[model samples]
Target chain A: MISRLKEKGAGDLLKCIQCGSCTSSCIVNAVNEYFNPRRIIGSIVKFNRLPDQDPWLCSSCSICVERCPQRVNPLSVIMALRMIKYENGDAPPSRVFELIEQIKKTGLAFPLSNEAYEKRRSLGLPELEMDEESLKEVKKILSEAGF
Target chain B: MSMTLYLGCLIRTLYPEVEKAVYEVLGRIGVVFEEPKGASCCAPLGLFSLSKNAWLRLNERNMRLFQSTVLTVCDDCFASLSDAFKILSEKNNVRVPEVKPFGKFMLEKLEEKGLRFSFKGLRCAVQHSCHLLRPARNVDNAENPMVVKNVLEKLGYIPVSYVSELDCCGGLVFEEKMRDAIARRKAEALEKSGADCVVTTCSHCMRQLKSVSRLPVLHLAQLSALSMGANPEEIGISEILLRRMVNP
Candidate 1:
């Protein structure tokens, strides 16, 4: 388990001292019982395995990092574990997928109609246009980026 | 010069006027924008916990759409794209294209892609997105709240101070009841801060802040637009109101 985490550059998990600082600082646990950084770390250290779905409760907010006295970045640890799950085809729900679909169908993500553009121009803003040449350039850039 | 502008889901759906304001403002500053076809969301919503492969793939695809450069006016978009770019570039051992925190990524990507465009120095306040500040370690002084101040100072904006500038607006957890109290506390503190206008990088933060405060909330792009002489009305502040009447 340590090796797996280290593979993601989070070898610093060994630095944890079972301190309850992170657990006490966690906002999620304060509101919800599902999240406890101290318990998560204990599980990782003792059993070398994280609950398959329990870690998803984290908001990924770095409050724990800011409050930790041991300088252990528990958020990164959680992220590294989540990344492993994602690679294994266990990604959680994402609003981004729907958003991407919206962008594909519409040149602009927001519904910017011709009338809206005209209104903007009437307000003295320049016209926004998209041509085939510009589209081709955009596609090329995404391809190179491995998109 | 010409660059692809990344408008994230929130701005595109909830506050599109801000997007228009960004274009109008940047245009006055001599920044030419192209609405790239086939552009997609930067996928910030699931970024922190999404599968690395999916997140990186989506972001790389999103970044690839711009020919010369990419301009992300939304702070969430900037933070999401920047994180993905950093991770993918390092994992794949490729040259990471520079992503400008303000709008310079537009110039750099365009130049790298061999697209021609010209731009002038822009003076603007860059509000740091909370996600970028809180979760991400790349930002400086998240606790004291100075990432946007530094960016604006670097880009030449007179930085302003708000008492609760560093406090969370409770955006990420707004669905939680506790968020209301947290946001109100943050809002009152920030309102007392002496900024002429509040400039933020995150659409969520912008919405959350604007919902509770009477002070004008400007996206970094909106502030940039104001500096470039775009009318504040064009950004649709009046249309953005929630219509909740406070009983005196």
Candidate 2:
């Protein structure tokens, strides 16, 4: 499991001293106690599985990444774990899938609604339509990348 | 060198007001910038969890659209594109354009022009979003980020210090209630700061704070445009505050 995590670009997972700085500084953990980075790291290192907490709750804000004294990069470890789980068919939160679907459909994570389109026009902004060819290229890249 | 404005998904779609501000302010300052012919999402954080290779590849593809420096309005877009290009350039020796956050880019331009507006004394609470100030080595004084404060001060506003100045808005958290809790906490701190409004560089932070905070949330560009004499209707901000800002 450690080797898989390392291969997934979280090679510093073993350097974690369980100092709990990640938990203390975590924005998600500050609000919701369920998504604890320190406990998740300990569980992954010890039991070779994620804890019962939802790992998808991580916001990728990188505060934990910056604050880790051991340079363990808990954020990268969480991302690596998420990638592994996703590849193994662990369903992420529905919102993530919706975001992916939106990007796949429009080449944009936040697509403009009809009202927003009109608002742009009223505001004297240029049309934001992604050209057909570029959209095709974006779709092709995502498909090639296994999305 | 000229810059290409990279309006990533968040600013281009969810917040067209930010786009207008960027456009007007850059034009007013006489900075030469144009929108790219083809662009998409910066392949934001969610994609990294799905596949790192895909994220890097999409960013590299997007990077090809701009020939020179790329000025990004969204902090996530700045971090994602720059970090991806750092790795891609190391491995492939590819030529990559410089990726700059809007605040830093504006600071440089204002410094070069030796420009300073009259102090309006409008108190602003600044949210220096995480991606723009983190990973330590990438930014100086990451712990006590002054970019937003400096930009606001140069644009003639008083940056009111707040207890939760460094707190994340939790825009990245997928859980609705948890996200609101974090944002509400930050909003409460900003509210207690006695500031007239909240100012931020990231569109996600603006969205999150605007949703939860009673204080009017302004993008740095929006504030810049307003202070530099743009009408409220032109920049899409409230006219009353605009009147106080422009005439002051």
Candidate 1, residues B44-76, lDDT tens digits: the string is 544435435555666776666656555666666
Q: What DockQ does candidate 2 have relative to the true complex? A: 0.76
Task: Indicate the worst ten consecutive residues by lDDT in candidate 2 chain A.
Answer: A47-56
Instruction: Give candidate 1 regions above 4 Å deviation.
Output: A1-11, A18-36, A46-57, A63-71, A80-147, B45-48, B103-127, B134-140, B143-147, B150-164, B174-182, B191-197, B212-215, B237-248
Chain A accuracy of model 2 expressed as TM-score: 0.90
Q: Which has the greatest DockQ?
A: 2
Q: Write the per-residue lDDT of candidate 2 for residues B1-248, one digit (tens) a residue.
A: 57888978877787777888888898899888778767878777777788888888888888788788988888888889889988989989978888888888888888899989888878888888888988763553688888778888898999989897888898988778888999998999999999888888888898899898998998999889877887667676886665555455
Q: After aligning candidate 2 to the native by TM-score, how far in Å is the CA of B216 from where it should be?
A: 0.7
- CAPRI class of candidate 2: medium
**Local lDDT at A143 for model 1:** 41
Off by over 4 Å in 2: B243-248
Q: Estimate each model's TM-score.
A: 0.67, 0.96
